[model samples]
Target: MYTEDLKVRFYETDALGHVNNTVIPAWFETGRLPVFELFTEQGNLYEVSLIVANLNVDFLRPVYFGEMVTLKTYIARIGKSSFDIGSEVWQSGQLCAKGTTILVNYDHKNGHSVPISEAIKAKLLQQTHPDHPLAS
Candidate 1:
């Protein structure tokens, strides 16, 4: 699993002083940059052949502003033309949220989904969690 740590900023909080629900998805997106780099030599996120096909976020607990959180990311599964990234947001040793994003490998220039490259597929297979629900 890969982990990135970040602190909740003042601006990310809502009127109740809790981190806003909308902010967590943005965190998930940013935390995947390193994973994206694994597929592209250009080092640019936009240059990758990926598009979000689906995203599900479950907010388990409220996080206060300035609280430190750890975002854990891992390949949950790799399908023919899509893959799932499982993520967790933990704060103060408690899991505050969990998320899964399904990304379709695509030929953007051709405007259609495409299979992941064999090299990328192998990397994802090696990195996928053994116990992940869909990994097998």
Candidate 2:
């Protein structure tokens, strides 16, 4: 798993002084970056990157500005050409939200989905996470 930390921005808050629901998805992406980074020795490969096939999010608690948010990312499942990555946002060690991002490998030249390489598959499967979703 990979983790990324972010500070809640003032503008991200709603009238209730809590983070807006829409902002959580962007935060999830921030956390997903490092996981992808592990696959490429040179990060430049991300420019010709995979695309999201699906996204699932669950908001558990309210987040306020000035809170330190940590986003934990890991691969939950790996398929032929797609991978399911899970993430959760935390505020000072308290749970705030959780989600999954499904990315399908794509050929930049062909503009279509393709199978993930064996190197990437082996690397992702080697990672392990505790079974409990809430704990992760």
TM-score of each: 0.91, 0.85
Tens digit of lDDT per residue, candidate 1, span 1-136?
6789998899999999999999999999987787788778878777888889999999999988877999888899888889899988999999999999999988978899988888998877666655665564
Residue 106, model 1: Cα distance from true site in angstroms:
0.5
Clashes of 1: 0
lDDT of each: 0.86, 0.81
For model 2, residues 20-107, the per-residue Cα lDDT tens digits are 9999999888777766675567787556467888999999999899878888877888888888888899997798899988888887
Candidate 1: segments with Cα more than 4 A from true spot: 130-136
| Candidate 2 wrongly placed segments (more than 4 Å) | 39-41, 132-136
Which pairs clash (backbone N, Cα, C closer than 3 Å) in model 2? none
* Best-matching candidate per TM-score: 1
